[model samples]
Target: MAQERDVNPWVKMGLELGPVIAFFIGYNRWKDDVFTIAGTDYNGFVLVTAAFIPLMVASTLILWRLSGHLSRMQILTLVLVLVFGGLTVWLNDETFFKMKPTIIYAMFAAILGFGLMRGQSYMAALMGQVMPMQPEGWMILTRRMTWFFAALAVANEAIWRLMSTDAWVNFKTFGLPLALFAFFMLQGGLVRRFGLDNGKG
Candidate 1:
């Protein structure tokens, strides 16, 4: 893995978010075009879905080349995107793409929930190398994240069902990141209260 100094926060954010932004742009620009793929004419959504898979793969590859390793969460997300995105293009349906977020959030919730049940905190396992914290802190944070992911899954389902495609795309591209930022900020107190003191102190 590359050292923290090697990864610029702004660059990391751009690499992580660029594909979704590309999809949003691609969709809006080609929404009126009917493209033929695999002997089937597809709508703008499918065209965007097709484009998304490659963009995501490319971004992930770039990240790996830069960082020397991909995080577990990143790999899981890429796999889901390819699966759902491929289905969206192959089946000429947007439902698969729409359901991708729900699946991702639900899977995370389930994984964390299962870890909690087994007296394990997967959050610590996932992030402990970077952020040292007390075990109790990990437990609390894990539970909070589990519920938060569940809530996001539900919210994604509701928005996709109740809102237009463009609105859902906006939510995915903008609202989700905002919510995540707020959530992280809200947990600052807990982190401070339960964080472990390294020898550097």
Candidate 2:
């Protein structure tokens, strides 16, 4: 097993969220710059999408260097960002970038849901080493997360498709994080009720 490095919670949060924040800043700063790439006229959204890809890669690398390991979810997220972000920049179309979050959420939901169907708890498999829990707790958490991720996917689709670019960007930058914080807060009761003593279950 890889040695687990102790990371400050604030630092972890910063590493995870910094790239998106950077993208938002970069977009707002260059939204009107008449930039052209690959024979396509680029707008704020396209430029931000382009910037996001490299920032995500650099962030993931920093995370791995600091923690000595990258979680599966992190790896999956970076891959999707690169692929979808690349498409968005290359095509100079914002649709691909807008769909990235929905794709990611749906993929996670599907993975967990499939594991549950197979009588396995992927939540435990992914996080169990760090957070040991009873089988029941893992099952409950996995089921909850599967549904939560599905809901997020639907929400992302609705927002990007129905809202303007600025609204969609705001949702991505602020709304998603708030929603996740609320979701985790709501899970506190379940965690307390099911958490094992001695950090092992």
Best by TM-score: 1
- Report the poorest 10 consecutive residues by lDDT, candidate 1: 192-201
lDDT digits (tens) for residues 1-201 of candidate 1: 466336677888899999989988998999889987667899998888888899899999988887778878899999999999998887889999999999999999999999999999999998997778889889999999999999999999999999999889999998888998999899988788777774322
lDDT of 2 by residue, 1-201 (tens): 678687777888899999989988887788777776666678877877877888889888888888888888899888889888898877778899899999999999999999999999988987787766788888998999999999999999998998887788888999999998998899877777777864555
For model 2, name the residue pairs that clash.
none
Off by over 4 Å in 2: 37-39, 198-201
Q: Give candidate 2's whole-model lDDT.
A: 0.86
Candidate 1: the clashing residue pairs are none
